[model samples]
Target: MSEGTEPSSSSLALLHHHHHHPQQQQTPPPPPPPPPSTASPSVAGAIVRGYRKGNWTLHETLILITAKRLDDERRAGGSSSSAHCSPSASTPAAAVPRSAEQRWKWVENYCWRNGCLRSQNQCNDKWDNLLRDYKKVRGYEARVAAAHAGELPSYWAMERHERKERNLPTNLAAEVFEALTDVLGRRAARRANAAATPVSTLPPAPIPLSPPRFPQPPVIPTAPPPLPEPAAAAAPPTLPPGHPSASGTLCSPIDITRIHLEMSSDSSESENDDGAGTAEPEAKRQRLGSSVVRSATVLARTLLACEEKREQRHRELVELEERRLRLEEERTEMRRQGFAGLISAVNSLSGAIHALVADYRNGNHR
Candidate 1:
């Protein structure tokens, strides 16, 4: 063969290796899971003579749960896609059905269509058991979170109080409730959020430090002008002493002093009226000032109370932060100690191996 026809060293090496070792066989994949059982309950069935009988498969349980959730959404008049019920992104339904039997029937129909083929009674019983287990798991999870937050003592006390109120603790293992909480946890979360309200979220009462603005009172006159008096009739021109002035009258003399006294009485009565009018307005202004002062005092008290509550909450927050920092420091110290012990252990193990090797070498020499 010519130089150009010669095989490369790398290709020749691969050929030789392949020739020395036969091709390895590929491995087969694992077998598929068994299909769902279609057998009905019988005397010899594992149901133990009770309708609860056979254990529900994971597939069947999921179908029942999904169907019930869909029915709930339907009742709520909400539009939700089937993908929402998938394990990766399961969401809470909008609402639960008010009619139990109707909800169960719908669940049964859905399960049947999806190849689960379970009776309404079976669906109802299984769901109830699942829900009860879900609650137990959730309660246990709450205790774990509380423990991590250093609140286990308070959490345990609360549980004891609940027991005294006739609420019993669950005995079932939390493992049995796995996969359940992942799907139903959102519903419980929604309910809790809806019920909970913090004091801080409340709107504060508006305080008006300054008194409310009132329309200014009109300026009142201290004294009113005197009332007009009737004018005295001019005495008949002194006609000849007794001439014709007494022609048809008995000549009665005009009393000038009586007229002056009557005019004086009218003027004094008008002055009294002006004085009463002035006093009335002054009394009204005094009443308005008193009421304004009372309102301002009440507002000041309310503002003080709000300030006290804010201070208390701030102090509590600071204390909590101190506790968290202390816990973090303790954890760091523990980690450092653990690492030191690990290093010491490795050194001791290396020394022991060296000692064993030395002993073996000495034995061979002997």
Candidate 2:
């Protein structure tokens, strides 16, 4: 057993079988590796992976978003010579207390302040996941909105809990939605909807041209009973001045009928006066309603006219700019032609001078 040479195959086989028995499989696995050095981000990342590898908690996510916003502000206002650059804007720098490793380590420290306990790598990973999920929710919302005729509902219009059977249409959680909204601002669709709300183009409801007619009282179809002869119904038989009827002490049939007819006419006239009184307020109300409608119409027309003028002004400016550019190009071409003509004239004069010099030389030689 203690020999230097390797053990025979049969002995090796027996040892392997003895150690790998099914009963031994129930034993616990080995302990995880010791935490790594923090000397480098690479090693630090490994330690984070080993320490706490799980889904981010909601409070931790909120902290991350808040910290990111603060970091951006601080970086944006930071001195160009010493500050780590904000994401898109930056200037030259030599060094600072710590490196801007992916511009995230400081944010990680911020999360740590809230007892988040996540490394920069974890923070980065979680942030990317949150964005990815947020985008997916946005896309789903867009698709849902497309089915309707008009603009989509705003993100903040509905509460987070109501977005599902409860929420508007997105199932994303309240914390995540709010965090993403704060970090990213409103989505494009939401912004567009908000922008379009003020420019309604449909004409205001048409105003009726004339005041409505008042309802006429129904006419009575049956004619009054034939009046008694004037002698009977018109005047109580000219009773003697001291007669009982004249003194109002008693009435004959003729006098009674005359009183009845006279009383009826008086009651009818009083009813007409009461009807006029009741009709006055109703007419005033109708006039008031019409005046309001007319004022609204005038306002709407004014707004439309202003909009048209703005569009017309824009068109004129665009046309003027085009004309200016065209004239500039033409002016450039004319200058180019003028320079060419000057060069051609100079060459022609030089040729004539050469011919003249030749003629003079010939005559002198002769």
Candidate 3:
């Protein structure tokens, strides 16, 4: 073919390469960047309904209130969550049944938004269970006392004392009154009307009988007995005012029964005093035990959360390490392929140049 008609060797070589490789079609665009992992608002809203959220029992509710009160105490002491706080990005629920933690949170929110409550006792759930728990504790205390005394402690008196000290009757009365007020509005009026009603329908009392007069012989008044002769005065031995023998003190009392009764009464008073004295200590011990239990619970939860966080971080680190090693291997493979392609292209160009030179040399010789 003529030089003008045929394409140049270099150009033909480039055309051959393009025809074989064709530039690498553009790479799919990279998967669209993975959809966000969060749930849609509409779906979340549908899941949070009546039965979905757990129920709040009476005791649980009471505990929630106590927890709320504690939170208030903490907040009022100037601790705040503001530094790390951020508005939640998640969609709001229409209504969610609360877990224990959520219930406490709700209680805190309510307490903070509304002013102080009138009374904790306003929760008039029958405290029979609470009373039973209290009694159980008392029994445990009695057993402890018995163990300490090396004999069974008489719990009857202690129980009576506990009843009054705990004001169980007062609590019951208050609960009953509150219930009545709720069921019967204007209980006072009913009570007053009942009091005003007459008792005239009852049977009358019996009449008293008059004593019969008895006849007795009249006797003349006798003269008083002559006074006994005065004995010689003897000086009493001097003794201290509090001395056992002071002021003619006798060794034995004339009335043993009276003395015994007085002694018993004194002993009873001492026992009462001892009971009262020990009560405050027992209360302090119980409070300390409760605080310890709460602290242990909080610590356990904190430790568990920390452990979960650590494991998550570890998993992320492992993933990152895996990704890095994979990328390193891919980069090394890409370099190897690029180097191989460069060498192949150079070799093709050299061959094309050599052929053109050989063809020129042959044409000149001819």
Highest-lDDT candidate: 2
Compared with the true structure, what per-residue lDDT tens digits does model 3 show for residues 146-201?
Answer: 68564544434355556556433312233333333332233333333332221111
What order do you get sorting by TM-score, best first?
Answer: 2, 1, 3
Candidate 2 residue spans exceeding 4 A from truth: 1-50, 79-102, 149-171, 186-366
Candidate 2, residue 81: the lDDT equals 26
Candidate 1 per-residue lDDT over residues 1-366, each given as its tens digit = 566456676688777876776443122222222222334433233454233348787778878777866775575343234223554443443343247876677787688778786778888888866765455445655676767765443323455555434332433333445555554554544333322221111212111321223222334556644443321122112223233322222112121222222222222332436645454334433533353344444544555476557655755776699899999999999999999999999999999999999999999999
Off by more than 4 A, model 3: 1-273
Candidate 2 accuracy as TM-score: 0.29
lDDT (10s digit) by residue, model 2, range 306-351: 6557655755776699899999999999999999999999999999
TM-score of predicted model 1?
0.27
Top TM-score model: 2
Q: What is the C-alpha RMSD of each candidate to the true structure, in Å?
A: 37.5, 31.9, 40.2
Q: CA lDDT, every prediction? A: 0.51, 0.54, 0.41
Q: Which residue pairs show backbone clashes in model 3? A: none
Clashing pairs in 1: 47-53
Q: TM-scores across all candidates? A: 0.27, 0.29, 0.25
Ordered by lDDT, highest first, the candidates read: 2, 1, 3
